[model samples]
Target: MFDRRSFLGSAAVAGGLLPLPEALSAQALAPVPLPPPDLYGKNEDAYWAALRRQFLIPADVVNLNVGTVGSSPRPVLKAIFDGFEQTEQMTQAGSEDYPIWGYGSWDDYRKPFADFMGAQVDQMAILRNCTEANSYIANGFDMKAGDEVLISDEEHGSGEMPWMLRQRRYGMVVKKFAMPKPPKSPADILNRINDAITPRTKIFFVSHISTATGVVLPIKDIAALARSKGIVSAVDGAHAPGMMKVDLNDLGCDLYTGSMHKWLFATKGTGFLYLRDEAIMDRVWNTIATGGYDDPTRKADRYMQIGSSCIPTLMGLNAAVAFANAIGIDRIEKRNRMLADHIHAEMMKRGAESWTSPDPALRCAIATVNVPPVQRMELQDWLWKNHKVRIRGGNPSRLRLATPYFLSKSDIDRFLGLFDAFRKMKGVA
Candidate 1:
């Protein structure tokens, strides 16, 4: 075990990623100092390295809660602001000159994005965040008071609210079931859903990855089962799109929603929703309409594409998707997992139990550590304010960590070092 005394005095913990580059020596690593909060424009890797460079985390402020949000990459940020400024300039140049809705604008966003996620261009729709994506289906569902919907405890408010909101107004019953602890097998989780599902169950809602638990659910199997039962399966894919492998068409779920901002590395407020050609096309009616809202059948498109968005961010999403594909999804997933495993291993070495999933197959780049006796906020403040290390945290009084594709094993080692230091300070045996 990575015992307490050894944890504090260990030379292994010396720098603790302070000059994270030291630990990154073995890899093609580049540690950037994070930009001062005031500045949000820079794309050069070296500039980015400096920006991500100094994280003063000391358990007092490790932001491990990435399920809620992720920091934008330097390039993505630069692209967004640059695009924003360019638009401002274009608008100043005059309306006719600044043709906003050319048939080409949204189409440029199509093929590349579809290629990245392994879906056909027409099947993917550029929507905002997971909430909006899922809501499209949730609000459009053809339901009656007697119908039932199945969801897991891991469902976020976005996934849960629409159903509940409908329940109050529509009288549909929202049945939430708990997933198996550690979710050892797909069958283990499916059985729970199977039990709660009755003839009344018309739809199944699942999170591709539970934001609350860093646990990756087996959507394929569950989705197949839902299909077998003649129920529609809609997935809350907020964490999966950017964090791991997701081919919407192949996954076979009825509908899917995702946030491009998280693992997708797109600018914030950009995301997409996908519908199986058979699942949503023409079956759901548009609840809202605006100008040119002639056909209620084609209204789903208008429902989502309403109001203008960050033109550059949406364009950059296409770029981010292309970048992810060029890098290879499997490669990024492997790198992210390796860093997470490193952190888990070191925490285990120190004899600290993980509050998150331990099974690698059931987990992802995100993980949470249970910190005994110490207040989470207190620990977070100390680590970030004193040690200069950065980690994410949230409720349940634990540390949640997400290793993006950009992180490496040495980065993991650095995090472990700080964890070791903290354990020692707490006098953990």
Candidate 2:
């Protein structure tokens, strides 16, 4: 299958560079034990059962917080290592192999990436990370000193940083839209955004899923409203790609960016950015200064990769998407929701309430359970120090559980059991 000579020839021509991980060894991994077939069934519950077979998770920890980061399967990880090893081997031999890009052309990655996102291939740009992707949109927009850019408090640092930098440096107006704690309805949330809008509002920036408190926005309606107001919509979907089913067309946003490493289970340092069309994206400067500035078609690639980067990661990143496609994104999504529902139900049974997301339809794989500010801080220390369950600690009386598709119901049950035990031990019960 791997015509080593042909691929090596191509790699030499592209750029004499080899990947990391030193190539496959003679010894291979032993057969992995899978979950019981019956545990995963017809619905989301069943899908979870099937999905758990794919992951190679450590037995000691209950990793319900895939919301923050996810692990790719053995195949993807192996590919990543192969890329590194190949590159390193070539380098050691006083030769170089292909560059960071796998396809002869950038469109090879774009088409499949766009297909996954439900966007036209031409509109998508593969980026290094979510920070780079969001910065491209944030700093690239055509704006004046007083031009209004509306953003939510719930946004990640990636969305908030660039605009904040722009406001101070360039004198742009950054408007903060206030969302209700427990939003009455999607309309109520929209009203908050609408109320902030004025004639000068040129940009509407929000996250499809918030990384901090885990609030999932109704981006479709919000995007539609932004369209009516002639505003450019940019979403920080760092938590959406692998955690949920994200169709860019359905969301109706002008621009969307997400991290592959965080949720897609791709290797670290890969991300995606989509511009509705080329015409709108021209506002951003091409990060590459050496070449391709004159060629409009090549601008996207040049912008995504500025200089020498980890090509091995890209190869593995590509394989990660292929794996996701093979498994079915919808099936992955349904199970993530089912797992979140499991966590939510169990937390409620233990007498803990939430300041987290409520709209089940909008929520993806993440859910936050607050155990009263003081209670959470102490319990959080206890869980990690005394107990082995790994989770994200919080400041706002919450613990965020970003369940990956691979985590099992029994795992969730175990986490619940821990919480209930913790509650009784802490005297909450």
Candidate 3:
């Protein structure tokens, strides 16, 4: 058995990542410092408005599609650029640029990220995106041909598509449960999932928040129920980390995956996966073989070693975590929730409708509105061309509004005014 001491001992001497450049050799893999927070302001509104200035998003464009992809802030971009520049300037001194190998100390990066998500340093694996993380769990997880995996109907493609592939490859039975658009209550959600479980059910796979309608599932309740039945819980949390407070310890899932770019506002191609059970390392196989592939002691690191990928993006991800921490996760969540409420109320006043739930408990920053079927495509084009309001469209045939912490009330009002005017022009009641 790998004891705690031995696991940490291996971590201390573990091949953490690639070697550092000569200029950064003195500091080695030290965590990047966050910019000053003097301008964070005193009051809530002022504080949020001040935060808006840190991004490079153009004033002319109002991006309500943060759910689709988030734009990195100024500090994160700088970290990426600085790290990439340093990497490009490396020269071969003797045998190699700098000698450390086998995935060397991303501990500096990993520690901050772990703390942000309420996870242990050993349990986290920094990957490219949620898709890769989901794939790692789906492919690595040991399942027999007749085993069943329960999933929700509202999950994103990244979360459910992998399970489909797994079913085809391993003959694993995949079962789908109905997820209410605006869940009536936690009990209501649990009942549906509970009803779907069978003797062959081995895993409960669901999204923490639905990408289609922004319904925040009762993950802890769901996880607890899965635990009672001896089923593994795997959550796709692509939209959770930055938009809301995420405490992995409290969430109680066997596996979790998220994207840094979607809401954490990290540079593109940065994501992470968390595993609650260490024994899973032995059962789960790495999709890509690397230096630590065979070392069972490496645990999560085995999944993280994907050859020499974008280290700069990881650096930016570290910076992004620091940025969110400095802002305070609770404050960010409160702001986003408030923004979502504002949009929902305004849309209702304008005779607008939503496919997403308006209940505060069921929703967060995302709000998807139903557009008239005839004008759905036209509304998307008009919003982009005339108003420069970027949002997602489809599924229930609606506009998806994701309120980033940086966005102001004025920006939302501007979009609402344009949308209201368009409705009037189209002769919609």
Residue range 136-224, candidate 1, lDDT tens digits: 67787788997998999877888899888989998989998997655666677889988988999998999888776677888899889
Candidates 2 and 3: which is better by TM-score? 3
Candidate closest to the true structure, highest lDDT: 3
Over 1-429, each residue of candidate 3 has an lDDT whose tens digit, in order, gives: 323333334555576744433333223233434334664554656666666767756777899999999988777876876676656555436555442223643677777898999998888888888999998878878999999989999888888888899999889988999887656677778999999999999989899988987888899999999999998899999999899998998889889999989889998988888988676566667887777777767667777777777667778888899888888899789889999999987876766676677567988998877766426668778889988888786754577789987888999999888877887888876
Give me the runs in candidate 3 sitting further than 4 Å from their true place: 1-43, 91-102
In model 3, the Cα lDDT at residue 391 comes to 74
Going through the candidates in the order shown, the clash numbers are: 43, 21, 5
- lDDT, ranked from best to worst: 3, 2, 1
Question: What are the Cα lDDT values of the candidates?
Answer: 0.67, 0.73, 0.80
TM-score of each candidate structure, all chains considered together = 0.79, 0.85, 0.87
Q: Is candidate 2 or 3 superior in lDDT?
A: 3
Worst window of 10 by summed lDDT in candidate 1: 22-31
Cα deviation of 101, candidate 3, in Å: 8.3
